[model samples]
Structures are given as C-alpha cells and as structure tokens.
Target: MAARLRRRLALVALVRVFKPGTPGVGRRLAAVPRLIAATLRGQYDGAARLATMAVAAIYLVSPFDFIGVAIFLIVGVLGDAALVTWLAGALMDETERFLEWERGSGRRPVA
Candidate 1:
C-alpha cells in the first residue's frame, strides 16, 4: 500500500537522526566500523538486517541504475529518493540499537 510505503520512507526520521542527543548522526556514523566488526565477530545479533540496509545504500549510488532514468527521469529519481529516505531512517534506528548495545544501557529485549 502507498500509505505503508510512505510511512517506510520516514523523511522525518532522517532529519531527526541529526538532532543533538546520544544517537546523533555523528555518533551513529562513528559507530559503523565497530558495528561491522561486532557483527562479523558474531557479537551482534542484527547482521541480516544490517546487510539488507547496506545493500540498499550501495544500490542507491550504484551506476547500474536499478530504475533506468533515461526514459523515466521522475520515476527513477523518485525511486532512489524513496530508497534514500528509507535507508536514512533505518540507519538511525540500527545505529541507536548498536549504541545501546555498546554501553549496555537503554531498551531491553522484549520478553
């Protein structure tokens, strides 16, 4: 559904990622390497989801062009725009989780 897709985009989350706080964009970006290391070492539990988001990000800048723009500029760009929004929001959330995992604080796993 279009409404669900729009919610997935979460442009506001992209903006909020940069807001000053414990999980700001600067801190999030800083943790990426550690996150990857932890995942590869089997210390983190969200590897699959992280890989999916990484692929989405790589595809966004990928020259192969998932949605060719030559004939459908608007549609093609919109597709990338939507992917960007989704990736940004997902990154914010994933990084927040990683940060909590790092400090051993914040939300606990649902029981």
Candidate 2:
C-alpha cells in the first residue's frame, strides 16, 4: 500500500513537471484564488490553512534560527497577504476611476 502511494505521488510530480498546463496545475492555481477568497470571507478551511502551514514549515526548515524563523514566517505571511489584498483593492479603485473618467469624456458609446 505504501509503495503504491509513493508511486502515485512520484507520477503526479513527474506529470506536473512535464505537463505544465495539466489539470493538476489548473486545480492548484485555482486553489490560490479560493484560498484568498476564503481568507477574505473569514471562511478558511483545513486545506487552505494547510497550504499556509506548509509555507510556514518551509520557512522553519530553512537555514535560520527556529524562533526567529517562525516569527519571520508569521510576519511574512501576514504582510504578504495584506499587501496582495491592498493591491487588489487599489487596482479595483483605479479601474473604477478610469471607467468614470471615460464616461465623463463621452468619447465611447455605451453598449
């Protein structure tokens, strides 16, 4: 059973490396949006949180002091998430402003 599981995992890794746009890539990429949306909505689930925890674990295992690595990981995750959220909000605001300006100019016909 363990051997079968290892083989399956190895096959998945190989496929992900050789077939960049496979369904697995799409699913993992899709998970990012779902993760962020869940975070924003305060509905984080085990899978999404596990993804974050994995990142934190990587940070912990890196060549750094354990306590400092953990603190850095916490801060990094919080800062990165906040930055992304803020950037998205800024992008939406900019897009809305551009649309408003376009409407005011009356250069384009409404569809």
Candidate 3:
C-alpha cells in the first residue's frame, strides 16, 4: 500500500511539473493559437498545411481513414480554438458597443 501511494504521488508530481503554466510550456500554449490563426487566415502557404488540411477534411468526410482521423483530431483542436477566439472577439466588440450606448444615454449608473 505504501509503494502504491508513493507511485501515485510521484505520478501526480510529474504531471504537475509538466502543467500548462510551467515555464517551458508557455511557448507551446502560445504556438497553438498562432498556428490556428495562421491556418484560418491561409498564412501557411506551403505543402505541409495543405497536406494536413487535406487529411483532416478526408477524415471528416469519411469514417475509415485512421491516419486522417489522427491528423483531423489535431487540426480540429486548433480550428476549435481559433473559432472560439474569433467568437470571443466578436462578442467583445458587441459588448463594447452596448456599453457605449448605455454611457451615451446617461440614464444608467456607471459601475
């Protein structure tokens, strides 16, 4: 029981060491959004991006391409992140406009 507890503790410690806010992980976390934005904006103008997207699309359309499925999983994560960012930006813009309108009306108490 002691040995199992120690092993589990060690595994937890190892996972914490590699957690997202750790020093070395910052670059990778930052890169994910950059990659997603680049892909969405068509900035990755080479064979690699094309190949990745092609495989992803194939996997999306068909259910049997194992390799394509893997590729799609990775790209889909990035795409989802990009979509979230895009939607958040739009939401912020709308919120700002609403706030501006409220301020201009001089009827609501400012918080």
Candidate 4:
C-alpha cells in the first residue's frame, strides 16, 4: 500500500512537472470552478481540506513569503516553482476528493 501511494505521488509530481499538454489538464481546470461551487454549498465532507486550499490560494497570491525575491533569484528560481507545484497538486487532490464525494452522495451530474 505504501509503495502504491509512493507511486501515485510520483505520478502526480510528474504530471504537474510536465503540465500544459497533458490529457487531464482541461478537465482539471474545469473542475476548479465546480469544486469551488461545491465547497460554497457545503457539499464536501472535509472543511479542513477546503480551508487548506484557501490558504494555499492566498499564499500563492500574496507577495510576502518566507523567501524573499532576491533570495529566490539567487536560488535559480526554485522557490516559486516549488510553491506553484505544491498548490497545483493540492488543488487537484482536493478537487478529486470532492468529485468522489459527489459521486458517493448520489449528486454526480448525469452525462
């Protein structure tokens, strides 16, 4: 099970690293608004997950950070990339969880 989880993480990381031409990019982008709507309606099972996503979004937009711009520039642009990657992964994971919840609750949209 642990190995399976590790492999899943690696896969997600690789997908995020090579974004912009991936198969699920469009679907994932579409899901973001739906996720937010579901979240607003209190449809998801976990408030903690929603709050964490909110915090991540805020952090991404805020100019302040633990690492200054000068420091990031010195580090060859790793800090921003790492933060964006983490945010993307978190959003994708949260959206997927919400989708599962929708299906489980019999609220999934009919295609």
Candidate 5:
C-alpha cells in the first residue's frame, strides 16, 4: 500500500526527470563534468550513483562481460546497449537531483 505508492511516485519522478526535449539539455550535459568534479572533491551526496555510473563505464570498456562476447555477439551488443541506456538515465536523474540541491542550498548561478 504505502510502499507501492512510493514506488509509483518514484517512477513518475524518474520519467519527469529524463523526458526527451526537457529544457536545459545543454546545462544538464555540462553538469556531467561538474558532477564528476564534485564527486572527486568529496561530495558524497551522489557518491553511490557516481560509483554505479563508473562501474557501467568500466563494464562498457572491459573485455570480460556478464554476457560473454563468445556467446551471441548480438546479445552481447544488446546487453551493452541496455547498460548504456541505464547509465544515461541514472546520469540524468543524479544531475537533476544535484541541480535541485544546488538551487535549494543557495548555490544557484547568478543569472
């Protein structure tokens, strides 16, 4: 009941965060570097997400994969694509959260 409602709300929020043509695409893209910098500088707010993103990145490059290359090449490629898609969504969600935190904490840029 309560947990299900929370899950539903979270799904809705995730969709809202990553919807295509959402404004600030450039700003969001720019935030990737900033996010990395912040994470490296010891900001732990998004450390878990950053760690997952890093692992996804490493999996993309690593020769060994859960879906082995020797197995169907198409399946391996599809697995990689799925991982990339998840990575992109995760990045967007984390960046949106970071932006919200920045605004609420008086770190918003002067306009």
Candidate 6:
C-alpha cells in the first residue's frame, strides 16, 4: 500500500504538475474553490466524503500539537506520518476527479 501510494502520488505530480496541457495541478488548484462551491450547491455526490476528509485533516493536526508531540514523541511522529500519507493521497485523487469532471462538464472546450 505504501509503495502503491508513493507511485500514485509521484506519477500524479509528474504528469499533472510538470506536464503541460489540460488542467493538471494548476488547473486542479484553481478548481478547488469551484469544487467546494459545487459540493455545497448539490452538484457533487461526494460532498460528504469531502467533508469527512476535511474533518479528518483538521482532527489529525489539531490536538497533536499540544498533546501528541509535546508529551509523546513517537506518537507525534506517527500523527505526522498519517497526515502526510492521507493528505497526499486525497489531494491527488480529488484533483484527478475534478479534472475529469471539468473535461466532461457542460462548457465545451475552446479549440
């Protein structure tokens, strides 16, 4: 799973961030606000998932500061690791989905 996640995130960054054309990382970054708006407007069925991911993100970092890292060094590091792993995978996947939706969206692409 670790190797798979590593490959997935690396390839995504290579193709989406470095490669030109299409939305890529920049396009996905731009789409973030739109994605949120769409989710709020009842456009995306995965809105609950998005909220859960966000909450998990917040939960991961919040209490870790004062309780996890300060008292338990190993636990702090583990929390950090989980944060990196989860956020990296989530960002890569969500952006890809948003890009696909953009391509299939109602607005036709300009030649």
Candidates in order: C-alpha RMSD to true structure: 7.8, 16.7, 18.8, 5.8, 5.7, 6.7
Which 10 residues in a row give candidate 6 its minimum summed lDDT? Answer: 1-10
State the lDDT at 95 in candidate 2. 28
Q: Tell me how far the alpha carbon of residue 94 in candidate 3 is from the true structure, in angstroms, after superposition.
A: 1.1
Give the Å error, residue 101, model 4.
Answer: 1.7
lDDT of 3: 0.40
Badly placed stretches (over 4 Å) of model 2 are 1-71, 109-111
lDDT of 2 at 105: 47
By summed lDDT, the worst window of 10 consecutive residues in model 2 runs over: 1-10
The true-versus-predicted C-alpha distance at residue 77 of model 1, in Å, is: 0.6
- Highest-lDDT candidate: 1
lDDT of each: 0.69, 0.41, 0.40, 0.58, 0.64, 0.61
Q: Is candidate 1 or candidate 2 better by TM-score?
A: 1
Clash pairs detected, candidate 3: none
Q: State every prediction's TM-score relative to the real structure.
A: 0.72, 0.35, 0.33, 0.62, 0.70, 0.66
Between candidates 3 and 4, the one scoring higher on TM-score is: 4
TM-score-better candidate, 2 vs 3: 2
Task: Give me the runs in candidate 4 sitting further than 4 Å from their true place.
Answer: 1-23
- Encode model 3's per-residue lDDT on 6-58: one tens digit a residue: 11232243344356643233333344443444446653222353354446455
- Write one digit per residue (lDDT tens) for candidate 5, span 1-111: 111111123234446664675536567777777667766877526677688779989988887875585587888878887777777666666777666555565665433
Question: Could you tell me the TM-score of candidate 2?
Answer: 0.35
Ranking by lDDT: 1, 5, 6, 4, 2, 3
- Candidate ranking under TM-score, highest first, comes to 1, 5, 6, 4, 2, 3
Query: What C-alpha root-mean-square deviation, in Å, does candidate 3 show against the real structure?
Result: 18.8
